[model samples]
Target: MRIGELAGQAGTTTRALRYYEAHGLVRPRRAANGYRDYDEAELRVVREIRALLATGFALDEIRPFVACLRAGNPSGDVCPDSVSVLRRKLAEVEAYIERLEAVRGQLREQLGGAR
Candidate 1:
């Protein structure tokens, strides 16, 4: 397949695919005519990238998962590096939730006093 086909199959854009290439997430070979050539495996990698991005993972943060996938893992998160990233992200989300709860409490107090 080509860049456009990979983008369509991955539910992303050609621009994003290019960006991923630049960032070393997806590596497509160059055809003899200089066109980008992708395989089904690259399509699967793109899908993994998109799924992680939807969960608020930055491109850099996704590097470990990509490495895991490239290492032949059936699922990227099964690797130790990927697991570590997930743990870190979970902690960050927990901290964010705590702050949001504090803000909500303050807002509730303000509303009650206003009434």
Candidate 2:
């Protein structure tokens, strides 16, 4: 398929696809007329990248996942580097929850005092 077709199938724009290429994430071969010819496997890789991006993962953070996919892993369940990134993100989420709980407690106290 071509870049446009892959982009449509991957639910992203050609610009985003080009950006992914710029970052060395998606590598498509050049067609005879100099157009980018994408492989079917690229659909899987692009989907992975989009899914990770939707979850707040930066491009750098997504590299490991892409690497794992290129390494012939069909499922999106591998990648030790991604595991590490997720662990850190989980910790950050936990800390945010703790801070929110503290704020809730403060608000409760203020409400009680006002009452």
Candidate 3:
């Protein structure tokens, strides 16, 4: 299918598909006129990429996992080092959430005081 059709099927924008291609995540063949032609396997890969991206995984962090999946590796957690990366990301997210909560608490207090 074309980029538009693939994007529609994957529930994402064509620009996002192009970004994935640019990142070496998804590679589609070019037609004679230089149009992209995505196969079903490529479409599946796009879906997987979208899922990983939604999980807050960095592109660099997700690359090895994608490779493991493509290689039919039995264990998805083959990258032991990724555990530390995930931990750091989790810590960052937790810190962000705490800061947001503190801001929200202050806003609530200010609103109560004004009332």
lDDT per residue (tens digit) for residues 1-115 in model 2: 9998998899999999999999999999997899999998899999999998998789988888888888888755477876887888789879989999999999999999998
Give me the runs in candidate 1 sitting further than 4 Å from their true place.
none
| lDDT (Cα, 0-100) at 48 in candidate 1 | 95
List, residue by residue over 1-115, the lDDT tens digit for candidate 1: 9999888889999999999999999999999999999998898799999999999999999999999999999988999999999999999999999999999999999999999
For residue 9, model 3's alpha carbon misses the true position, in angstroms, by 3.1
> Cα lDDT for residue 76, model 3?
35
TM-score for candidate 2, residues paired by index:
0.87
TM-score of every candidate relative to the true structure? 0.98, 0.87, 0.64
Q: What does candidate 3 score in Cα RMSD to the true structure? A: 3.4
Shift of residue 98 alpha carbon in model 3, Å: 0.9
Tens digit of per-residue lDDT, candidate 3, span 1-115:
9999999999899999999889988889999999999987777777777876898877876676656556665533466554566677789999999999999999999999998
Could you give the candidate ranking by lDDT, starting with the highest?
1, 2, 3
How does residue 84 of candidate 2 score in lDDT? 83
Two-way TM-score contest, 1 vs 3, winner: 1
Question: What's the lDDT for candidate 3?
Answer: 0.79
